[model samples]
Target: MSNIRHHPKTETLAAFAAGRLDEARAVVIATHAAICTECAQAIEEFETVGGAFLEDAEPVALRDDALENVLRRADPGVNVVTPQKPAGDLPETRLPLSAYLEGSIDDVAWRAVAPGLSQSVLKAEGYRPGVLRLLKIAPGVRMPRHSHKGEELTVILRGAYKDEIGDFAVGDLADLDAGDTHTPEAIGDEPCICLIAAAAPLRFKTVLGRIVQPFIGL
Candidate 1:
């Protein structure tokens, strides 16, 4: 299971078990769980160990017809929905950060996260504090070794990156936590583009980086 080095936090696994995550994020976690037995087992453990807490905060009992009412509105016939389409509308651009952002990576004002690093936060129409983050890694560069203060989830958008963990390519999702420390570097000829989300700030553990932590505002 160590082959699948990156994984989500136990809290996030609990959230997933409680059916609180949205469809898009849930798909990302589910896909990773499909390939990661450690995480999968961890999720099951959460289900077992945390079940009592959920039971204590009991919800009002549903009406006998509540399920029937829901099923009536949901699509029962599979043919009614459109078939899945491949993603391909993104433009290839000169600016390194602009290439992989969902709509306009260029539209965002880039922030200097570190000397050789920059970040562009993609704001949705109504995305709030803990929604989404798109990070661009400069070539020949690596982020300071650190772990997330909260659940940090990442999906590789373009190029590749690797740390002590395995390499990540487009479509690969990585789940990291406060327990994990990694220094990921952009690989090959291009800068790496990744989509990330976190509920808390990242804490850099390296002494040099920690000295400048206040200045860098990380």
Candidate 2:
């Protein structure tokens, strides 16, 4: 049995199935679905419906030389790019995050953001200004209170955390927006590892947090 308590919204899943979400957000949702069977099944269902819709839609005529142009573009002279396999030795969390991690979680070189809190930023090619990171919070540690500037998505990779919303364990996703606010505290003996993606910078409530926010680039 799984202990997932939070999930991406139905519309978000549908957007993901339709290939409509931004790359960063999509990766977050995909990672969550990898660990949550219930969400995975839901995404599959949405994909099925999407396929049916595509099949039922009428086809549009293309340019007269469309096929010829495509063939010409595919010529040997043109660069043939091959997809690169994800580089990592992390336990298959069943997520599409390996490519970004580049190595196992243990291999990550985390930087201290504050006492008991460390973070490693991840870069996604098309996502700029949006924050994508791996956060490691020591057991029984409470993160500084803060609210988001935009939407924030967090997928727990290991351990658990408690906040105003509720307790989040492995495979659980916390979806928060600008209007939401909470202080998350790590629970249990081990550190809580989470993959987090945010649309904008966070607004820390305390003076110390605000002072260090720029340096940490959170």
- Estimated TM-score for each candidate: 0.57, 0.85
lDDT of 1 by residue, 78-149 (tens): 437674333345532222223234435445567877776767655422233354566788777888888877
The global C-alpha lDDT for each of the candidates, from Candidate 1 onward, is 0.66, 0.85
- Angstrom error of the Cα, residue 204, model 2: value is 1.1
TM-score of 1: 0.57
What is the clash count for each candidate, in the order shown?
1, 0
Q: How displaced is residue 42 in candidate 1, in Å?
A: 16
What's the CA RMSD of model 2 in angstroms?
Answer: 3.0
Output the number of the lDDT-best candidate: 2
Model 2, global lDDT: 0.85
TM-score of 2: 0.85
